[model samples]
Target: MKKEFRSGCPISSTLDVIGDKWSLLIIRDMLIKHKKTFKEISDSDESIAPSILSARLKLLESYKLISKIKIPKNKKENIYLLTEKGIRLTPIIIEFSLWGDTNMREFNKIKDVKGLNLDKSYIIQSVQDHYNSMLLNF
Candidate 1:
């Protein structure tokens, strides 16, 4: 579907899709936290409402950032995974993590991104590699 954009600016266009907090959090759960199921994502620290969660998941799927599927044996359950396009947001998530780690500490307690001991590129690559491994197994 062609989406209506408020402006042609890159950042604005990107935000038009993932601008909402729930959408970004949903992506975070899939990418960094490895939460694939509806229950798992809804049970996130943010405690998103079921209705909102369902809507955001559908929106993300519509944007081709994520994909939903059901296992052959369990047609009743749905598993959502980040597509390659979605995986591209890994670096953005990491950037947010790093920014929060540096600037948000005085206001709130936020954990550093996993593998803080390594370089930023390594952390991003490790996350992408882990997700790819899971995809391969699935």
Candidate 2:
């Protein structure tokens, strides 16, 4: 089923492409931790069902947000990685995590989001600056 979005805002449009509960988390797993295998992502706390994980990975690939590359030693297995577009979303995810940290008490235990002690804007800028530095070095 196609997800219905609230509006045509650019952010909303982007979210429409990936706003589902699972997609962002999958992307987050890749962007932050570099998780890159079907098995690794399937084992996340979301504990996504294999069918759903397969479907979501296909959708993300069709949209060009991620690419599945063959693992060097074993060409049979694929490693998922973010495209430039996918890496660019790190700030938005960081911002959402910051908001959740301050306002949504239940999710603090989530990995990587903790220990930063970062404020909303700080995290956003930090992600942006991190991406910027990456671009410079690349």
Candidate 3:
């Protein structure tokens, strides 16, 4: 069940759901790196602990930001995919990336990622396109 917040403020409500560093980082991995599996996500540069990863995954899934799918041929493994609500976070992610790139010296390391053009409109369109394609396949 979704947790109740102190008030109905949008920012506070958003924070209540995904305010933690790990949660957003997990979302970043999925949004930017396209990681879908536990192993893949755990291998991110942040190196989150397995226990913490599991908890955060549960929280994200509970909020309907992501969905866990059992791998057809590998029952022991599950893949995660973003829902429409999650896809809507692309702009915020891009804005954060831009902020990091502008303020931090090491932020440019991943700036050259293919299809991740610095153009805001392009990034938004790319995210929407990817989401639409995934829906079609589903």
Candidate 4:
């Protein structure tokens, strides 16, 4: 169930919906890894618990941020895909990643890390291109 907003502040409202660490990590998995299945999402680097993952998925769906679609070829399997609303979060995710890359010393030292240019328009464009390609394949 969605929580009631405490005030009209935009940030607060946004946080109310997605402030939890796990929620954004789930989004990150979808955006970066293109994971869809429950197993795939829960198997991310962050090692989210199955119960937490299930709850977050429900919340994301309730907020219209993602859609759970059953693959046409498989009756028992469903894949989660970002809605237009969820795709809008790409820029924010890019900014957060850039911040971590820049300020977090440990993150920078990670092996084979390809740094983004920190250009907002370029990042958004790149994400849009990827999203478009995914749509074509879907």
The TM-scores of all predictions, comma-separated, are: 0.94, 0.75, 0.84, 0.90
Please say which candidate is ahead in TM-score: 2 or 3.
Answer: 3
Q: Write the per-residue lDDT of candidate 2 for residues 73-103, one digit (tens) a residue.
A: 9999998877888887777787777777667
Separately for all candidates shown, the number of backbone clashes (residues 3 or more apart, or on different chains) is: 0, 0, 0, 0
Residue pairs in candidate 3 whose N, alpha carbon or C atoms collide under 3 angstroms: none
Deviation from native of the Cα of residue 41 in model 4, angstroms: 0.7
Instruction: Name the regions of candidate 1 deviating beyond 4 angstroms.
Output: none
lDDT of 1: 0.89
Q: Each candidate: RMSD to true structure?
A: 1.4, 4.1, 2.6, 1.9
lDDT by residue for model 3 over 71-126, one digit each (tens)?
Answer: 88999999998888998888888777766766774644544444444578888778
Model 3, position 8: C-alpha lDDT score:
98
Number of the candidate with higher lDDT, 1 or 4: 1
Clashing pairs in 4: none
Please report the candidate that would top lDDT against the real structure: 1
Given candidate 1, what's the lDDT at residue 120?
A: 92
Candidate 1: clashing pairs of residues = none
Model 1 lDDT-worst window of ten: 109-118
Task: Judging by TM-score, tell me the better candidate of 1 and 4.
Answer: 1
- lDDT (0 to 1) per candidate: 0.89, 0.77, 0.83, 0.84
TM-score for candidate 1, residues paired by index: 0.94
